[model samples]
Target: MKTLRFVASVSFGKDSLAMLHLLLEQRRSLDEVVFYDTGAEFDCIYRERDRILPLLEERHIKYTELHPAEPFFYQMFAHPVHSRKTGGVHKHGYGWCGGSCRWGTTYKNLAIAKHLRGYQEKVVQYVGIAADEKNRIGDKCYPLLDYNMTERECLAYCYEQGHEWLEDGVRLYDVLDRVSCWCCRNKNRKELKAIHDNLPRYWERLEALEAVLGNMKGKPLNEVVSCS
Candidate 1:
């Protein structure tokens, strides 16, 4: 019988690196490694991925990049710029997403599913939950857990694999434990504070987004955390 095809879901994070390493170590051939480009991610994530692209080529791994039809801003603000209310028009407003909202993930994953539709082989999606984060693990295979690897091991693997790419100056996990969109409501107090400290303008921009939306208490993402 033919072997199953593996598809690793990567976020350019520690756990992602560990899982991919394990897969390759197992002599498993990957059908593809998919990275969902949310377009709202930190710049460093892209930089790290760019650094590793050459390695993927050297390894002859098929790396795929997928993105939703609309970026985060456009997805959040679905209405047209032109409006009778504003006379001229506004480029942005709001539609339906916040910290509690999983709509953005849903849309992105559904787009990926469209790509996954044609595969004939049994495909396994590799997720990057660390063994320590087993609670978050569900039906998906947590390679870290399967390999008995912890988050620390994942970090070490990435650093060893690409120390130059994994620079201390701009590692996302250094500032934020979890990297997501800049304006995600899911960001905790520390992450928000990190945004304010390292990327003050971005934080201001997020606040500006809130200023335009005008529904902080009434909604999820409209409220900016007190970075003070």
Candidate 2:
């Protein structure tokens, strides 16, 4: 019989941070904490990871970081596309990922799955979904939901623990709902507008990508810049 290994998947977001804190507080048996880096996350997300590193070290919890085999830009701009009709290859990349075609999510999951395959033990992955997000609950173990913690409660708990996602005197939670990949095409207009207004460098990069890729979500990047 193989041993069971308990692992927590963290994104350094409010829910995940709260879940990790609760697991620690309750003295749960945690073998490791795994984080899948999308390579395009906001700076605050990385900073939050840095903030939590000491606690993981203090508790002697193994921390593993997994990254996609291909870079985000390469997947977006240079990936080869095979044409079924002509039996030829199109060098143009997959363009902007959105809806069900989110390649970033695919890459992240694949990387994590590949890493977990290395373990001979049975891996019980703990996700950080909140009670309010019951629709997102799957087969994974959700500690926050088990504790009846809502999304708002999770954020409150993280703030109470000094796990606020802050960058340049700006609180990220105040502007955006999720701190996922910065280049994600699924972001709403409000989130995109916030980035356009606050983060010029990132906005510029988005504009550059849009220039090369033509349009995203059937709209010009300038329209997002003028979002009210």
Model 2, 1-228: lDDT tens digits are 999999999999999999999999999989899998877888889988998899899999999998777887888888887888887885668788777778888788788888888999999999999999999988889999779999899999999998777766668788888877777888888888887777778788888988898776578877865865
Give me the displacement of residue 170 in model 1, in angstroms. Answer: 4.0
Residue 39 displacement (Å), model 2: 0.9
TM-score of 1: 0.79
Point out the worst 10-residue segment of candidate 2 by lDDT. 216-225
Off by over 4 Å in 1: 1-3, 79-98, 163-168, 215-228
Clashes of 1: 0
Q: Largest lDDT belongs to which candidate?
A: 2
Give the per-residue Cα lDDT of candidate 2 at 198.
74
Report the lDDT tens digits of candidate 1 across residue range 1-228: 655777888877678867887788787667678898888776667887887688778888889999877667776666454667877666554443555656677877797777766677767788889878878877766778877888887888877776433223556667777666666666766777777677766777777877666554355332335523
Q: Model 2 RMSD to the real structure?
A: 1.7
